[model samples]
Target chain A: MIDQPARARDFGQSRPHAGENPPFLLTTSSPGRSQRRLAVCVLVVLVGALVVTAPFARIPLENTEALLPAYAAAVFVNEVITASLLLALFSVQRSRAVFALSIGYLFSGVMVIPWALTFPGVFESLGLPDAGLQSTAAIATLRRLGFPIFVLAYALLEDSGSSARVSHGSARSVILAGVAGVVAIACGSTWLIVTSDDALPGFMKDTRNVAAPWQYVPATAVCLYLVGLCVLWIRPRSVLNLWLMVVLCTLLIEIVILSYLSAGLRLSLGWWAGRLYGLLSASLVLLVLLSEKTTLYARLVRSVSAERRAREARLTAMEALSASIAHEVNQPLASMVTNADAGLRWLGRQSPNVDEARAALKRIVDDGHRAAKVIEGITTMFKKGAQERVSVNMNRLIEETLRRCRDEARLGRISVQAELDADLPPVMGSPVQLQQVISNLVANAIDAMTAVAGRKRVICIRSARRNSDAILVSVEDSGTGLDPKYRDRIFEPFFTTRSDGMGMGLMFCQSVIEAHGGRLWVTDNEPHGAIFHFTLPSADDPPSTAGATVR
Target chain B: MVMSDDSLIAVVDDDESAREAVAGLVRSLGFLAAEFGSAADFLASDQRSRTACLIADVRMPGVTGPELYSHLMASGTPIPTVLITAYAREAARDRALKSGIRCYLAKPLDPDELLACIRSAIGDGKGRIE
Candidate 1:
């Protein structure tokens, strides 16, 4: 019985996951993400060189004093795009990694405006109150420091596969806190720079003071963190993690270049290159994430279609089963009605034929029980409940299944021959499900033989002890043999040869057999036709008995 | 209104218990009953001309009730058939009625309804014979 929720979960389970089925060679690398990372690396290198060469080579391009506004606008656009992309990624899958990354981007995008406003010349020229170069340096330092910290946190969360997600209310609070913190830092730094510009150290006064001892502190700390992150990357993880590590590596190189170019004036080519590298690092993960999102969407579409097809096939199978159920139930009902009438007639005689009436009443009782059993069988077979495994006599179950198919066999001019080992042991399984397996096989055999002319139609069912621990049952039909090409695909769900066939019968049989810790397979019978064989562990087996005993 | 026991009603059904039970009811109604496992068996038997009414299941192995009715009609021996079915298909009932079947009844058949159909079928047969 397949419940809707349970089957939906099964569909989710069918999706391939990295940790679920690990590769034989445990490597944390992905070629696609690696290629994207390489592209990012090349872009960073080209931009880094261009920025570094501009000041020393005395290019026609103006210095930081003139190009400041254009640089600020470019940084603003990059930051905004990065933040939006991160938020989009967070929306798709609310992981700690994405949340942290989004917050980092948001902070950087907001801080860039304040950083540009206080960068000495640009906003001061417009008569806007500027926080001076000290606040500009502080904002730049804070922005650069913010990204790596968030990225490292994201990497840590990725390492812990089941990272905790923030609740809705808490997440909103966290975002509010982050915005307040960024605003506070920006305002506080401006206030300090405005009130005490002369009290600040020489390193904060200008971009050319790279030799200041305080400047090395944040750079060394960032380098140490980057090294630690590199160590984490040495171990195997997902493709996403690997790409993030690559981004971090490039960011580290950009940091080194930024510190080196800090010896030059503001908006020096190296400083601009450093900013470009930062933009590249931020964009790398977003690009990979967007590509992954596309792949996931494609997978989702494929699975949904596959699920729909499976459902359609199941409906078709149910229709066939319902027809069979109607026939099975109706026979006994007709018998019961007839017997009741017979009993009444016998009793209505002038000299009541009591013996005959008693016989008719007995038949009525038997037919009533038969009808009830048929209803019970169908209910149990189709019920959306967990299957209950019990010790079931295989021979008896096969006999009952054959009895159900007797009418079909007769109509098809098919002879059914059952050879049962008298001493065969019972197996543990759902009797109704097992019975369905046999009935489907027998019914299929009967249907297969309908096309045969002149040749004797014979269906042979055999049950024997495969060993002390297992019992084997086989159904063989003397009909058109299975084609070699279709033999492998016969058990695939919805793969059908007949126009009227739903093609789920064999697949259902195989699943039931496998769920019972058994194996079901097909083979070519001698001369003609096909044989389906399944093996069930004997009830005497300790493992199988354990399951039934628990019930 | 009295009918002799020699006036036989043939009950053809794939089910043994149903065939025997219907036969028993016919016997109690002052008619001799002949039971056949299937329509083919009834056709093979020598009781076709003597049978006053034919009560047969709609679905049978070799020949269905309506098919037997048609065969009889084609042979110039139109037996009054009351077709019994487990599945109450309106199309089958319509087809059976159009082919001049006396009645079409679904299974878990009402004994009273069946007896009435059987009596009416016998009356029709007798009228035709006279």
Candidate 2:
């Protein structure tokens, strides 16, 4: 957790757009090109497989007694994982549609346990109370019918742009209620099917032969699956909707193979194929959700890092601006303090020289006004500044920034050369911000050269017309050439080579250039150091009178 | 208090009000006060030899206070110097002190501190003010 006081301070000072909407959820996000293609391809493959095996579906195969238990175990595990993941997503998204879908999966997964326990051959040897012959088929039919109904509920509720968000405290209760409801329904269905076993229509004439009415059960399930698929297809499809449609299609194929095409033969090729289809249907949505979560995680990491760098760059610009303003105000304040002390000294004198005392007092009053003027200038410059954009001559701006660096250049024994185009058109920007951009670049150039001893430290600044609409300025320093390893990372905040460096200078410069509708980049200055280049779009109209007065 | 007649204290700063106020304080202490707007102006002035103590702002447009002090020492006319600045960069201050500047002070200068620095700068024995 972030510290409260620090977060409160940063609330207004930084992160102006922190309250923006979070990354898109799968339920709301439209399927992308690759995702849509993959979903369609999977549906085509399932349909092709079913058609190829349809004629041979009824041919009986050797019965493996373990297959039923194993199939049930796999379905149970797959459904539970899928349902829990969907519910977890619902907890975060608080979307009612996702909650409905998850509850459906939960009910289907829980029904498998009772269906497996009551199958005639499996439990006969255990000496337990024999389950009715109809119990297994009844539970299996109910589970299949239950899933498509939930999907229909999900589709009906999936309105675009309207999130049915429950309040925070109620979200937990809502989730609990959905879970309890699924459990209650599964238990109620199992109890009713087991108690009324003899009264229910026989699904099998014997252990190996199907009854006449069993065809109606699979047909009804197939109809429900089609309705779910149709409703989902009618809605504007999101990633979640697209995958859910795939799930419904697989269920339709499973039902047709199990009863309609199997020709009343139990443990046939068609029956095994139908069970495999059921497992496939259970795994499809879970796989897509897992992969989507991974992709979203990667995107989140990149965006967070980018945001942190931008914030640091802003902090650096603020530091430089505040430092300069403080220096300006302090000069006048210092003068006033000295003047007041002088006035007091004059009055304390033995002769009490009235004229000298009065003159000293007058200077104090003047210094006080000067200090107030400094504050007033700042108020106009920043608080109400409006970041007044104007057409600025790049040559003059570069000259001013370099002049500010004159002392540092002299101390470092670096020589500066300017080859500016005299006819370069003015570009529109805030003069102070543009000044900062150039100063930061020039300062970085000087720093890059400070360690050089054998070669002369030189910085060449050039400005030229890049095209009709743009002007380019390059600061090339003959210090150490840009490190090949760090070339890309140098512009990142807090990526400094020097111990004393804050590593904010270049990042700040890049941001300022970008904000002014320009681009900044760095390249190796041939045979020696790095060349930093920036281009600004030229203003179409002639420079305004107010613009000419900025510098 | 009165300083020796031969003592001249030169005050140099890019800021007009700061220069005048520092000069005014020196004058009130009974020493001859010379004010210059920039280090370049002070360097071109004819009062370099006559000046007993130099009070200059560390940061200036053309030439800075510490630069002027170093230039004077190199030119064999090392005036006792006290460096002052509104923006007191620690690195610049340390460098100035190590180079034998008489004193290094941040702005909003205390009257007593300035007097003490000036007294020691001009050799306490020859230009003492009491």
Candidate 3:
């Protein structure tokens, strides 16, 4: 449905004038931000490398744990440094929540500080008769440091822009899926976990002859579920961080399945499953964490494309703009010059009674400047843009756009009318840009009335400062009314009835009005032509103070 | 201060604005300023008497200042004429002299230049421009 209509040929229905596109590229400053991020990433990698590469590592293996002295000295350093580097990168874009969490992670790594102060006789109290304390400390390093680092990554994901882009499951959906999958895995794995023992053609089952059920069933089921999940959620740009989830669920699937079947088997499946699940889930989490860079790279490319298109459109509009202004303003400029020249020549004669000529000359000079100002205004109209929100006079902008539309009204033999509300307050946005929006609407109203034979050729423009943070400008014409269903399509570019003319006038008006942090739409006019309505920011929006953006 | 057959008027313009502003000026001047948005709007408008005067813009829509004078000869609007222009180049001035316009006026115009020509026009029989 969407594909067929958009491709149809129609006058005025062309690609959007560049304004609708993203703004163009930044000048030389984009690289500065990239370089800073790169430096930080490299610093993190180097710190992590130094800690892991240090020789001799120790880990405590259970309460019966002992670690070699040299090993304790090595792996403890590796874990702490890796944890610290991750903690630093997490602080760049900060929030109170992230700040508090990173502090907790930092202190946990700080907790590893006291490991350096171990006394010589600690091995006896640690209950390691033969094994060294280094062995016990070995597992301590990962449990203490690795878990906190994972939590930090979770915090980063929650606060980033990519939060929306990442795949998400509702709390209820997750719980439902969890319970259902667990039961299904249990049934599916039961047969796999236990090998059937048959004797004498199903005469009787013998428990004494059968092996203990604590065998391969649970571990094998979990491994299979792991492989299934990997295939399900592994598409790029689908679910972020799902690979880790696939790993975690794989462990549970194996354990539950094995527990059911192990009743008929004879091995410690739980212990084996637990060991493998921990290693694999941790590996998957780290691998996903590394994928964050590519996602950011993709977003940057999208941002660049949006910018380039907007700039090109603006450039095309500007080239023809200068000539239009000169044509519009030349007459007034000529009259001003004529009056001024007459006065100057009169003064040069140095006549005794020159007061009459002097006054005429002065009026001409003043008139010349006034004429110049209007020309200046018409030419500078081409320079309009910049999205600084600010307070503006709603009534003033409406009256001015109405005044400019007088020429159009005269040419079309349309009578223009106004019902302005004096009590209207200031609205926010660029006054000139806002004027363009109003003019475009008023122009459209006049155009719609061109074919109407004789009911009424009146175009009504009204403005008000009511409604929250909004000022309204409405243009109503008496012409062929649009069907109610087609109202929404009117704002879409290239949607117009005029055969030779571009239908962009209203669409451009809509975009301009919208960009001001406002709204635009069409509705039924009073028993006649369609009404083009829009809002501007109210007085509460505040006045703008920035210079124009140079494209 | 109404116009008479013995009185001659001149108009100088190339666009619609020129027609309007000049008509307003001519009305103020107590003579007729027959307007032409172009030489075409002018030639299309009626003219009478060789005794009338012409005030032609140096650059016209069609029918150059010299050409306007040449066309006037056959039509007999035969009033002495003045040439007025924004770009008062030497070529246009020489053309006006050769074509029999008594004076060529530069733009950013002086009402005095026009008034003086009108006074001279009132007296001359052949509409000779001073």
Q: Top model by lDDT, which number? A: 2
- Could you give candidate 3's per-residue lDDT for residues A396-463 as a string of tens digits? 77666665555456446566766676667776566767777777877778778899986868777777
Q: DockQ for each candidate? A: 0.37, 0.54, 0.08
Tell me how candidate 2 scores on lDDT.
0.80
* lDDT of the candidates, in the order given: 0.70, 0.80, 0.49
TM-score of chain A of 2: 0.64
Task: Compute each candidate's TM-score over C-alphas.
Answer: 0.63, 0.70, 0.34
Model 3: share of real contacts kept: 0.12
Better of 1 and 2 by DockQ: 2
lDDT of 1 by residue, A234-297 (tens): 6455556566666676676566556654443345556566666766765676676666667667
Model 1, residue A341: C-alpha shift (Å) = 2.9
Position A456, candidate 1: lDDT: 72
True contacts kept of each: 0.60, 0.85, 0.12
Q: Counting only residues 3 or more apart in sequence or on different chains, how many pairs clash (N, Cα, C under 3 Å) in candidate 3?
A: 41
The parts of candidate 2 lying over 4 Å away from their true place are: A1-23, A125-128, A160-168, A385-551, B1-7, B87-94, B124-130
Query: TM-score of the B chain in model 1?
Result: 0.89
Q: For residues B66-87, could you state the per-residue lDDT of candidate 1 as single tens digits?
A: 8889999999888889998888
- Candidate 3: lDDT of B51? 32
Ranking by lDDT: 2, 1, 3
Model 1: per-residue Cα lDDT at residue A108: 70
